[model samples]
Target: MATKTPKNPQKKHDGRRKNLIDNKNLKSPRTGIRKWVYRFFVAIIWFLILLVPVTIYYAHDLPDISEITQPKGGSTVMVMDRSGGLLASYGDVYGDWLEFDDIPAVLVQAVIATEDRRFFDHGGFDIRGFMRAMIKNITTGRMVEGGSTISQQLAKNLFLSADKTLKRKIQELLFSAWLEMNFSKEEILTYYFNRVYFGSGAYGIDAAARIFFGHNARELSLIEAAMLAGVLKGPALYSPLRDLERSYRRMGDVLDNMVEAGFIQKSVAEKTKAENVQIVDKQTGGDERYFSDWIVERAASLIGRVNEPVIIYTTLMPDIQDKANKALQRIMDQEALTHKASQAALVSLDMDGGVRAMVGGTDYTVSQYNRAAQAQRQPGSAFKLFIYLAAFERGLSPDDVMRDSPVILKGWQPKNYSGEYLGQVTLREAFVRSLNTVAVKLAERINRKNVIEMARRLGLTTPIVAE
Candidate 1:
């Protein structure tokens, strides 16, 4: 009876637990807290495990910054003017780089407003814009609207090729993520504004302003900035110096963008636009295209491959080339109208192998077939330099005697230009006079291979042969 004292006194229990650990599950008073800690650690690990895919997708979804932070300019191969002055170059022709601190806020605002209205608001990938682009691409069945921001453009310039594919987009996204992690927005914007092509062979905005407008980037007026910004679409197409009307219209579009983005007031935009941003006409008179063509060919030969464009350092006199160009233009203009399909090409290089004069074509814009060194047209009697060398190297001085006569070589017949068949003449007279018979006779005796070899050793770029 004493053992059966019913201790089921419905202990008026408070529903709220006094301890965080469940009392029923406690293995021991000592082990209770340890079990709770173990479960807490398990929950934390499960949460992290679930977040891993989200993190990976986020990383892949982010913009790639690897390209933008790279050294962008000065990789260009510069072709110096014959006087050792830097005339023209290819690749990124920038001596000075623009940094965040040096860049003007106005320029930054202009680019952000004109290029991407929501540049600052978005992560590297613009979600709203991307969705919009996706809709357009889906509906229109074409990749019409590209959702690339200023940062993405920098990435493309620095690391990616200009390929508009899904792979490029995915790669761009990953690279953009790296970029965001590495650089600040201002730094990204500075690189974007400084590295993007603005035309006239200018790689960066500073170079564009200086090259075209002849003003520092900081000194660029709103209208001038608009004109230079317009060149980003197509430098040659929107070049103010090349196409003033197109430039004005393009700049007007940029002004509209600036106004819409609230970077500039509408009234101010209209006033600036009306103030005549007429780009002054600029013509590079010392056109070194012949040398450019020559250098391109030479570079291809030296590198031994032509997969990508090669940059060449050349010794070309721009002024002299200009004079030669003008002179050749006059001569060709006069000659072309008089003769049908009658072409003339002149290449004058110095003894040290520097091109001093060149006339590639009458009009390169019309016909880009560079004739100076590209064409294989018979030099007619002009190629007599080879023959003179053939005779001279054989101990025949300028005043030596030579007999002009008919000769045959391996089924080919050789004869003098003179129908009178001049029998004997001095080597100098024959050389200066370009007599063919004696020159051919000397070539036959001197061995044609040795004669051609001498011509090659003295810097004949192209192959030569004596017949």
Candidate 2:
């Protein structure tokens, strides 16, 4: 056994060489796997490169088409009446719904100059704008404002969700490009006029026109138009109805912008501001806060939430909302004075089911609990709205007869409210009186379930339990 080892010393080298050759053969397959991995990564990088610019283009360029559909209720021209008292004070509602024609050229010029001078030139994403903005920001040592075009802002409002992420930016760019290709500049401007919010639940230029100047978009003078245009810079701060000083300052800026953009001469801007403005007092602007609240809630259904920055255009009657507000406030004041634990609510709904007004409480500062829209209460005799409406819907005319007498109802004897029993009375009289016994008798006669269903169909969200 010991003598056999010396003959195969070279054989040992031969076996080692064979092992190295086998390892080299396996390395080729490994190299192929590495190549495939590299190709996959390269494809993803290319996609991101193409996607970022395109996505940004679309999200920043397109108009929100969904908002242009006449909102929930009311027409555009309901705001033409304003003298002595508001149109809404006597139950006449005023709301403006502006399209392109309602806007002033001066207002448009001012916005274009102040916000994005190159808005007409850029294809959604403006490289020159980006570069200039970057340079300016770098030199200033902070980001003052983004050079986002109106189209981009519109795109963000319409399609792109306001999430600060690279993916969203890509979507925005892509959509912007498509928008620029599909829509004309005038079309884009039209959508922008109707979709942008102007504080106080004013969705479009039309709504803003009615609220601020007591007129339609068609009636805005140069100065009145400038005031509205100024609001675009800061709605809550420069709302002409809220802060006159801030509004005047913003109007001046708008005038300056118009002058710079060559839409107006310097003298014209000065003349417009001095002679044309008619600022209404904030206190007398009328109260449509309840209507605003209604729109805010419904707008969440349209976009996502009010906080999401999704654009909303609604057809709420400003006058009706104001009326509801005053009436509700009056009732709440009376209730509070009479009872310490009392809180009142009022709601005004249009024929089309658009909630015109919904006041939850008198004290918004004390609590934001919306009593009208959110609270569930035992409404007492006020609950008769369901019974009366139910009867009317069933073809029961006001002249229809329903016997009103003491009726023993399921261990609970329902009686006349005043303890005076009329031998026979019309259901109308009983409803007007809000008699509990008549309602109970009718509940016994008609399908209680059907009446309940009717109440529900009529937009009563409260739970109806038959006793």
- The candidate that wins on TM-score is 1
Candidate-wise lDDT, in order: 0.67, 0.66
Per-residue lDDT tens digits for candidate 2, residues 309-414, read 2333445555765677688777666776667746667776667765655666665544334567656677778667776777677777788787777888568886
| Backbone atom clashes (below 3 Å) for every candidate | 9, 23
**Cα-based RMSD of the predictions, in order?**
20.3, 17.0
Q: How do the predictions measure up, each by TM-score?
A: 0.47, 0.45
lDDT of 1 at 264: 83
- For residue 230, what is the lDDT in candidate 1? 75
Which runs in model 2 stand beyond 4 Å of their true positions? 1-102, 137-144, 282-467
Which ten-residue region of model 2 has the weakest summed lDDT?
74-83
lDDT of 1: 0.67
lDDT of 2 at 446: 69
Tell me the tens digit of each residue's lDDT in model 1 across 330-449. 887787777775556777789876777776666554333456775666656755676577667776678888787676678777766666567788877777777777777766777888
